[model samples]
Target: MADKGPVAMIDPSQLMRPEPTFNDKPLQAYRDYTIDDTDPIKERVRRTYYEMHSKMTVDLFKEKREKWLKFNHFKATVKDALIRLNEVVDESDPDLDLPNIVHAFQTAERIRHDHPDDDWFHLTGLIHDLGKVMALYGEPQWCVVGDTFALGCKWADAIVYGPESFKNNPDTYNPKYKQVSICTKKKNFVTTTLYGMYKPHCGLDNLLISWSHDEYLYQFLKHNKSTIPEEGLVMIRYHSFYPWHSGGEYRHLTNEKDVETLKHVTEFNKYDLYTKSEKIPDIEALWPYYEKLIEKYIPGVCEW
Candidate 1:
C-alpha cells in the first residue's frame, strides 16, 4: 500500500496552504447559498427558514434569547445527537456518494494517514467539516452553509458569494468598503489575508460565523471550554469561513492573532478539499480510532 500511497506525505503546511479549489461546489461554490432542487421536502424546509429569517427582525434575536437564554432542553450528548444528525444525507449532488458521516470520516482519515506526526491536524481532518451537519441538524440550507459574513455590518465585495441583501446594508454605503473607514483600522474588519487576527472577543466564542454546524457546534464548545482547547473550538468555528479560504474576504478585520490562526485553518482546508474521494472509508474500520480521538479532544457526548 505504501508503494501507491501519496508520494509526499501531506505536511500540515500542505494541508493548510491556499490552492485552486471548488470545495463548496455545484451549490455554486463560494457563493451565497444553494437551492433545494425545489424538492417538496427540501422546499418546505427552505420556506420555513426564509420566513424565519425574513421575520427574524433584530428585535426577534432579543426576544428569542431572553426566553431561551438558559434553555438546555434541546441539547443532548454528541453521540446521541450525532446518530440522529448523521441522518442528513446529501449524495444527490454530483460531488460524492458517501453519507455525511463517511464524508467527514474520509476527510479526517486522509489527514490522519497523510500527517502521521501532526496528531492535531489528524483530529482536524475528523472535525473540520463536521459543521456541515447543519444540514441534518434542522438548520435551513441557506443559513447553514453560505458565504458567511458580519450580519449587521456593511458587506464587503470580497465576501465570496455574499448575500444580495447586504448591498442594502448601511455599511455598504459607508466609505470603508469602497474606500476606508476613518474609525476602523483595517478599513473593513478582517485582514488582507487570513494570516493576521484579533481576539475579536476573549475567545472565538464572540465571533460571528454564518449560521451553520460551525456556529452551532462552536456554541457547544464555548459553553464547555473546560472540556476542549481554544484550537479545537476554532476548528468548529472557521471551517466554513470560506471568504478567507477562496480569496481574502475579510482582510481588514483580522488582527495579529487571527493571522496565526488562519495559517492552521488554511492548512486544514488543503486536506479537506484534496483528500476527498468518492469511496467512503469503512466506518467500522475508523470508528475505534475516532472514538479514542474524540475522547482525547471533545467530550464523548456534546450538546447539539
Candidate 2:
C-alpha cells in the first residue's frame, strides 16, 4: 500500500536470511489442513515472513487500507472473479490438493443452498478470505496474516503465536500503550483488545481487528465506499480472529450490538472452519450459476 518499491528499503539482512523450511512456526492461521507439497520454498517462505513482520508497523496497515479501500467497487464477471481469486494458491496448505477456486465455491455453494436470503452473507463468507492470494505470488506470510498493535506507537500481546518478535518492535514497551490502556474511557484501544475498540451495542462496523484475508477483502468492498449492511461489513472484517469471537478475549469492549453481529461472524466462521476436504466442486458446472451471481455483484476487470 505504501509503495513497497519506495518503502521496502532496508538492509539485505532485514530481507531475511533465506532458508528452506519451517523452523518453529508452521502456518498457524487454520490447522484444518497440512502444508501442501508443492515445491519446497519452506525456508524462503519462513525467512521472508520474519523480514516482513519485522519491518511492518501499524501505520503501514493504515496506509494500505487507505490506498486500496478507496477502490472498493468490484467490476468482474463470475469468470473474472474466479480467475482473479484463482491467482491465490496455498502452498503452505496440505490441502492445496484442491485448487483455490474450489475453496471459495465449496464454502459459497454450501451457503447458497442453506441460506439464500443470506446469499450475500454466503458470498461474503465465500470470497472474504481470498485476499490471502497476495501471498501466493511471494508476499511474506507475516504480511499475509496479521499482528495486533497500535500503529502509532507500540505492539500488543495479542499478536498471535510466539510473542518474542515484538520485543524489538520499537513500540513494544512504549509508555503511550500503557498510559492509553489505563487512561482512556475508550479503554483497551490497542489492537490487542478488539472488544470495545469496535462500536459497542451498535454494530460490527466499529471494530478494529488484526488484518487478514477477512480484512483485506473487506477493504476491497469498503474502499468503493458502497453502502454496506453494517453487520455484513463487520462479519467480513473480523471473521479470522477467534480470540475475540470464541474466547471473548476482549469482552469489556463489546457492546450489545457487537455481540449480535458477532453471532453473525461466528456463523460465517463455522463455514470457513468446517467446509473443506479432498472434495472439489465442478467449477465448469457451477460457472453459469456463479456468472449470474458475479455479474450481479461485481463488475469485470478489478484493479487488483
Candidate 3:
C-alpha cells in the first residue's frame, strides 16, 4: 500500500502558491462573497442562509444534539463514508458545484503538498465534511451545510448576510435577542446589567451553534474514540465557523482552550476554502496513501 503513495511530498518552499483557480471569478469569489439577486446561484445561497437563520433556534439545536450525538445512525469505514459524501453539493459554497468528494480530495492534497509532516492533518481534510452524509439520511441541506453561528445568543451581525437577514426569524422577536445590541460591541453602552439582570453568557462549548456537518463529524469521531488528536478534532469542529475565524466575532464566548485551538483551525481553513476550484484530483492514484492514513487513525467501521 505504501508503494502507491506519492513519490515525494512537495515542500512549500519549492512551490508557488496562487489564488484558487476558477473560470468564473466574479461568481466564485472567496468565501461566499456575493448575495446579489441577479445571479441565480447567489440568490439560492441567500435563500438557504435565510432558512438557516430562521430555523436554527436554540431549542432545535438542542433537539438535534440529543438525536445525532448518540452516534448510532449507521456504521461504515472511512472510505465508505467519504464515498457517500459525493452525493452532496453544498449550497452554502459559491466556489464549486462539484461533488463534496472532489473538495475533500482537493483540500487533503493541498494540505499534503504544503505540510508533508502532518499526516493527521491530511486525514482531517479528507474527512472534515464526511458528516454531510447526513443529507442521505433525510437531513436537509439547510441543517447540513452553510457557515454556522451560535444559536442561543443574539445572532451576531458578523454572520453571513448580517442580522437583517434574520428579520423574520422567531428568535428575532425574543427579548433576549433584542438585547443583542448590547453584546454587539457597536455601541458605547458601558453598563453590563440590562434591567438589573445579567445577560445570557457562556464559553464556546456551552453555546449551542447552528447544526452543521462540521459539528456532526467532530462528535462522531469523538464518540468512536478515534486516534485523531485534539487539534485535528478542533479543525473538524470549527472549520465552518467563519464568524469567529473570518469575521472576528464572538470572541467573548471563547475560552483559553479555544484560543489555542484557533491557530490550527485557522491553518486548516486556508486549505479548505482556497483549494475549491476547477481542479480535479486523481482519485484512484491518491487512494492508497489516504487509505493508509485512515487505517492509522480511524480504522474499521466507524459508527456514524
Instruction: Judging by lDDT, tell me the better candidate of 1 and 3.
Output: 3
Q: Can you tell me which runs of candidate 2 are displaced by over 4 Å?
A: 1-56, 70-78, 91-98, 133-139, 146-159, 179-207, 225-231, 299-304
In the range 31-126, model 3's lDDT, one tens digit per residue, is: 554546676777777778889887887678878878898888888998998988778888877677889999999999989988899999999999
Ranking by TM-score: 3, 2, 1
Whole-model alpha-carbon lDDT for candidate 2: 0.52
Worst 10 residues of 3 by lDDT: 6-15
Tell me the TM-score of each prediction against the true structure.
0.63, 0.65, 0.84
Model 3 TM-score (2 dp):
0.84
Candidate models: Cα lDDT each: 0.49, 0.52, 0.77
Once fitted onto the true fold, the runs of candidate 1 whose alpha carbons sit more than 4 angstroms away are 1-76, 90-98, 131-138, 160-207, 226-228
Model 3 scores what on Cα lDDT? Answer: 0.77
Highest lDDT: which candidate?
3
